[model samples]
Target chain A: MKVSRVASVFAAALAAGLIFLPLWWVFASSLRPGNSFVENLTPLSWRAFLPVGGSFANYEVLLDGDFARALLNSFLVAGVTVVLGLAVAVLAAYALAVLNFPGRGYVFVFVILVSMVPFDAIAIPLSGLFSTWRLSDSYAGLILPALANGFAIFVLRQFFLGVPQELLDAAEVDGLGRFGTLLRIVLPLSKPALIGAGLMLFLSQWQAYLWPLLIGTSPGKQLAPIALANLSNLYSVDLGQILAGSFVLSAVPMVLLLFFQRQYTESLSTSGMRG
Target chain B: MPTMSPRRWRDARLAVLLLAPAVLGMVAMRVVPAVSAFAESFNHLSLRTGVKEFVGFENYAYLLGSGEFHAVLGTTLLFNLVLNPVIVVLSTALALLLAQRLPAVGLWRSLIFVPAAVPGSVTALIWSTAMQPDGLLNALFAAIGLPKQPFLTSSGQALGSIGLMLAWGAIGYWMLFVVAGLKDIPQAVYEAALIDGAGWWRRLTAITLPLLRRPMAFVLVAGTVGSFLAFAPVQILTKGGPDGSTNLLMYDVYANAYQVGDLGVAQAEVVLLMILMAVVVAIQFRVLREERS
Candidate 1:
């Protein structure tokens, strides 16, 4: 029994290490000074484990070039998408959860149907239509199509449903309007849900590849992923720079994941039907 | 006016008022685009002419009869088939182990899950760095006295490499759901099984596995849709690769829309993918729902 317990512990630790090794490799490589390809490879060495002669030269190389604009574009795109997605989701969620009205079922079903249409399906026509309207290569084109997410609305509504009726009633008795009750009473309580939804939406947009690739074809306007890819192609010699930019691109979501992992997992647990 | 008339009317008005922005956003962005995409599938999209002209079923027919389309469809299915079972089984096992009373489980689980927090685009970048011809993977091979393998450069190995990266990121995600599912199971059931002289394997098969069907089904269905829509990894790593060996359906769709500048065929393929997703989602939901009711 003791041996088996030790074996299970060893196995678990091994699995966790194997899973996290690639990320560690990226982090370690990104921190190492440039032009150390041979030294970066050797296994079972401190050079492979820790940064030797570490510096921010790789990050400077990335940010001083095309990556600077692309990074800014990523922030703009993700920020707008989150703010817009949450704005619409909160109102729609409140309506669905707090109000009594006809055709709400139809509206909810429409949200599901919206998500059922695949990204590729929508990207084809949307790119054309936006180009026709002279909206291509702009933030509007990049962010508009993604602002309406059914999963966000669904999660927030589910969370809103859990707010006690007594609180809402008390707010109403205190002469709070429907909007006031929602803002003062309900919204504050749904912080975890809101944060989870925002983080997911923001992270997805920050990493958005296809939309920016297809629409923002102009130079210096691509998002981080597209830009990083283009940078690697343009400067394929610098592996360190590539790894550094990827690490930087992942910074925001990593922080959010570390801080809000519980809420993030909570959303996934309840929102199974989402894409 | 009576209190009922005023209050009911106000609530109804408020509902409509509140729902308007979200509904409008959905219609303009999601609803209208989808409906127009279906309409556009039968038309030719040409930037040179600046006007899309109706071309009947030509787009669908061309795609249906094309050899490239068939190859992409086959690759898509191959990816799903290879990825889904591995993901489900491994993640389930991980979840089962994590659910056990182990030391430092929280830190271990977090480390396993941190990979998921890395965006798909960055994840692709990281994997590409690792899989390059003279990359770390080959270095490890040479150290172990084995010949270097062409990971992303070889046609046959490209798709498998991408799948490996995806599975690396996905196992922890599916594990989260599985852990949640396991939490809902009663401890007494497991205790009773143990008291009846049942071993770990028997308790798992009888009590744990049966109870896990719903969350497992949830993971499978969502995972299938996600794997089908996987685009970033293929784009960043191989770009449909050394000899088009890694050209999955999503890449083909992007190539049609952006590379070839043919939205008609892209929309046509998108329609096909959506139908596939709908069927997969519907069947999974129905199976789980039936089991419950």
Candidate 2:
């Protein structure tokens, strides 16, 4: 039994190492001074995975460039998407889960089918349409399409369904309107689902590459992922700066996700049904 | 049903008001573009001349006849064929391993999950650097007295490397669902199996796995769709190749529409890709349903 315990710990450590060590290396290399990311790796020393003589030089250079603008743009886009998306999704989910209406079942089915439609496959034609409306190179173009995520709606509806019927009835008996019951009752109780769905919407827009690539082409509207990708593609590749930029881009969302780890994981568990 | 009274009318009106924004947005944004894409796929719109002509089945015929388009489909299938299974197995294994009561297991689980939280493009950039000839992976290989690999630079190994990056970014996220499923299993089932002298492998195959079918199916389907939509890493690392070897279908659609100025071909490819996805999803449902029965 003790031997088996040792083996399990060893296996867990190895798995964690495989996933976490590379990220640690990225962080360490980003801190290294003056393009030494390669030289440090040659002897496979601890220096390759540690910030021994670390400095903020790469970050200083990166922040001095246009990467800051890209980061701000990403936040702006993701922020607006989350706020507006939550409003739209919550209202629809409330109606679907609580209301007695004609064709409610059909509407729910429609939402399911639409949620299953992969956006990447349809992005080409969607971009063409957006171009015709002259929405290219704009934030509206970036935020509008993502506002009506069917999967977000689906998740919210599932959570709302789990909200007990008698609580809603009591709210109604106390003279709460439909919107009031939703805002005061359903919304308050569904915090985890809201945060989870919001995180989902936020991450979808935050890491969005193809949609932003096709729509927001101008320099002023550049996003972090696009900027990070372009940083590495330059004729003179700066490894330190690229690592620093990637570290920043990756670290921000990771912090947000970890902070809301419970909500995010639970949301994924619910959303897994849509798959 | 009875005719609408005032209260019923009010309720219906409220429902419509509540659902309007989301329903309208979904229809106008998602449903309209997708439905029109099918129609547009049958027409030719020349970007250079601004001339539009109805070209019934010509785009599909051309794409079907072309070797390059065939290669794109082949590469996409090949990538998904390897990616989905590998991710499912590895994630399940990780989940099973973590299901044990190891010390500081929660911390290790979060550490393993950190990569999934990183954005795909950022992970690709990190992996692109790490896969450089003299980078960390090769340095580790050399420590083990193995040869250095040309990961994203060589066409032969580029797709495999991208798959590795994706698996690294995704497995932890998927594993959590398996962990959740694992938690739902009754302790008595395992105890009963132990009393019957079932070994670990037997318990897993007979007890844990059959119980985990639902979550496992979810992982398989979600992993398939995620791998099918994989575009960022390919764009960041290879740009479809050292020799067009990594030119998967999604990238091909992007290139045809944006770079080559071929909207007709791009729309046709989109239609085909959707049909393929629908067919695969249907097959997965059928197989899973059969197994359940």
Candidate 3:
């Protein structure tokens, strides 16, 4: 028993260290001396993971460009996606889970199939469709497809299914319409589920790279991932700036995680194990 | 809970009204695009003129005959074959560890789970810098007197390196599923196993693994699809390069459509990917069913 207890502590610490070391390195390298590329990042030295003569030089340079715009774009896009996605998804989920109607089974299967069709598979035609209408670079093009979220509907449906029939019936008896019960009863009762669904959609949009890579190619249209990726291609982008940008990019989700820690983690596990 | 039993006509109208927006959006975005993409696979499209000429299976045949498609498909398969197992094992191990009454369980779980929140592109860039010739990893190699490795530049190492980077980002997220699975198992089963004089290994192999099949299956299938569709890591780190060593199928399809302007070829490649994903998911379902029975 004693041996097993000691083994568990050592193993847990090692796992935690491995997961965090890269994150620490990125923050450290960003603060390293010199505004240009980091030099002498030898692993044998503590300076590799912990910089010496640390400064704000990288952020000072990076903030002067489009990085802030990109961050705000990600925040705005993801925020809108969540609000719109949740509104659409919650209604659909309430209908699917609570309402009895013809062809409901078919709709359920159809929704699942839609989720299976990988977004990347439709990249060619979807972008082509937008290009034909001259909406290829617009925010609608980015936010629209993202809002058509089936997984959010599915997660919300699962939660809605667990709501008591009595409460919904009681609301209906008290002169609540369908939407009224949804708002006054179901939505309020499913707060954790709503938060989960919202976080899932928000995180995906915030982390998006491929769609922005394709559609949002112009300078003003660049999102965070696209802009961060461009740092690598630029002729004279400082390495520390790249690290600083990555940290900033990473820090948003971390902050969100802190705010919605339980909801975020629960939703992730729910998404994977959903039947 | 019972289905809502409002006035039948009113319920029907309300249901349609509620579902319309999502249904319409999905139709325009996913369903319509997928149908058109499928149609494009059967027709020859000129990128410049935007003209379509029907040529059933010619595009698919062309893609099947090309050595590049074969190589890209094989690379994708190899990545999944290696990556899925790595994710399964690591995630299961971490899940099992986290399920136990270990020290700092909440802190450890928080640390592991945080990386999945980082954008895949950002994770790719982070690893790309660390794996560069004079970066942290190679520095470690030098510190131990080992010769330096050309991580992203070497064709042999490029694909595996990309996989490792993705796995680093993926394993923790996948762990949550298996941890959820482990949490579902009844402690009574373990107690019964202990009463039967079972050792730790026996108890685990017999009770835990047997009961945790569903979540493990979930991890397996989801992780396979994820690895199959991976794009950002390959794009950022290698750009499907170092002699096309890391050119995954999705990247190949993307290059065909966007770079070469071969929309037909990209659509046909997408069809192939769809079939592969379907078959993999089917096999997983069958395996899970067998275990359940």
Candidate 4:
């Protein structure tokens, strides 16, 4: 028993160390002042140990500049996408899960089929349409395309199906119309699933790099990822600022994850396993 | 069972109201783009003259003829072939490790998953920084008495480095799914195996593997689709590399359409890629269904 305990402790420690090391390095490097890429490489130095001397100059520079605009743009894009996506997903999920209609299976299958198409494959054709619609380089261009994510629809439908049938009957018997039942009963019961779907949509949109990079070319219009990429080219490749910007960009999602740790883990795991 | 008149109209209206925005959005964003891409593929388009002329199957024929296209196709296939199995195996192993009665299990799980939450661009930036000549990785290697290697600069090492980074970042997320699958397997099954004098390896093989079939199918298909469609890492880290060695088909399509103004050729590639993905997914579905039966 003692031997097993020792082995388990050792394994846990090793795993913990591996995971935390990269994060520690990112934090430490980001905190370092100045563009001393070569100087900072040494493992142990007075520079590393210097505490209060480090400044938030890099972050200040980022926030006071186009970085701020990009961050706001990302929030706008991701936020709108989530709200709009959930509205559509919730209603569609309700229809598929509860309302009997012809060609229901076909709709579900169509959603699944679209999920299989990789974004890169269709980016060109999509961009062409965006150009024609004059939605290119616009926020609407980003949010509109992503609003139709099939994964959200499918997952929400599955969760809706799991809602107990008797509750629907009870609502109906209570003189509630079909819409009323869905709005009050089905929607409330599936809050966890809806939140899960919403969170997934937000994260996916937030992390979107390719499509945004392709469509949104104007400086102020670019999202966070595009902004970060642009930062490397704006001035000299200021590794310190780049690292700082990246750290800040990464911190948003991390903070959000901490708040919804349980939902985040459960939703991601369930989605993967189910799909 | 009451008069279906009001209910049916309401239902139809609700369905139309709910699905209209998404359907129209998808039609404009997804379906339109897809159709245009197919159409573009059959034409010869260039920016100089702003003229597009139909040349049916010529783009496909051109892609077939080019050595670079063949190389890109080969690289894409190799990436999927190697990376999919590695991700599945590694993620399963990690999930299995975590599912055991390990101490600080929550911390381990959180640590692994934190990277998943990190944006892909940030992850790519972190890895790119680490893979530099005087970067953290090389620094550690030198400390451990190993020769310093140009991990990302070397043509041979660049693709593999990107692949490893992607796998490292993604494995944690995939493992979580497998962990969920593992949890759904009742503890009694493992206990029964233990009572029968089965060793750890046998318990894993006989119990955990079989019970995990459904989740495994999901992971396999998803992983395959994801690998074929991978873009961010290649774009950020290697940009298809020193000699187009790391260029995957997705990047190629992007380049064709966006960079080269060859929309038709790009569209053709997209259609081919979609067909390929559909076939692979269908095969996985077949295999999983057959296995269950």
Find the candidate with the highest lDDT and give its number.
2
Local distance difference test, candidate 1: 0.81
- Residues B64-85 of candidate 4: C-alpha lDDT, one tens digit per residue: 8989889999999898889988
Q: In model 2, what is the error at residue B290, expressed in angstroms? A: 2.3
Writing each residue's lDDT as its tens digit, candidate 1 over B1-293 gives 33557777787788888788878877877666777778888999677987879999999999989988888988888889889878999999989877776778887798888787777877888888887766777777877888878888889888888888888878888899899989999999988888899997898888999899988988888788889888888887788877788898888888888789888888888788877778877987897889768
TM-score of each: 0.94, 0.97, 0.96, 0.94
Question: Which 10 consecutive positions of candidate 2 chain B have the poorest summed lDDT?
Answer: B2-11
Q: Assess each model's interface with DockQ, reporting 2 decimals per model.
A: 0.62, 0.80, 0.72, 0.58
CA deviation > 4 Å runs, candidate 4? A43-53, B1-5, B285-293
Which predicted model would earn the best TM-score? 2
Kindly list the per-residue Cα lDDT of model 2 for residues A127-222, writing each as its tens digit.
Answer: 889989898889999999899798888889999999998999999899998888988999999999999999999998987788888888988998
Candidate 3 iRMSD, 1 decimal: 1.5
Please identify model 3 stretches exceeding 4 Å from their true place. A33-37, B1-6, B48-50
Candidate 3 lDDT, B1-293, residue by residue in tens: 45646576677788899999999989998988778778878988886687889999999899889998888988888889889989999999988887788767888888887788788999998988888888878877788899999888999899988988888898888898888888888888888888889999998887888888888888899888888889988777777998889999888888888788888888888878888998988998997898789
- Return whichever of 3 and 4 wins on DockQ: 3
For candidate 1, lDDT tens digit of each residue in A137-251?
Answer: 8888888777777778888989999999999999999999998998899989999999888877887687677788878888757888888888777655588998988888766
In DockQ terms, which candidate is top? 2
State the TM-score, rounded to 2 decimals, of chain A in model 1.
0.92
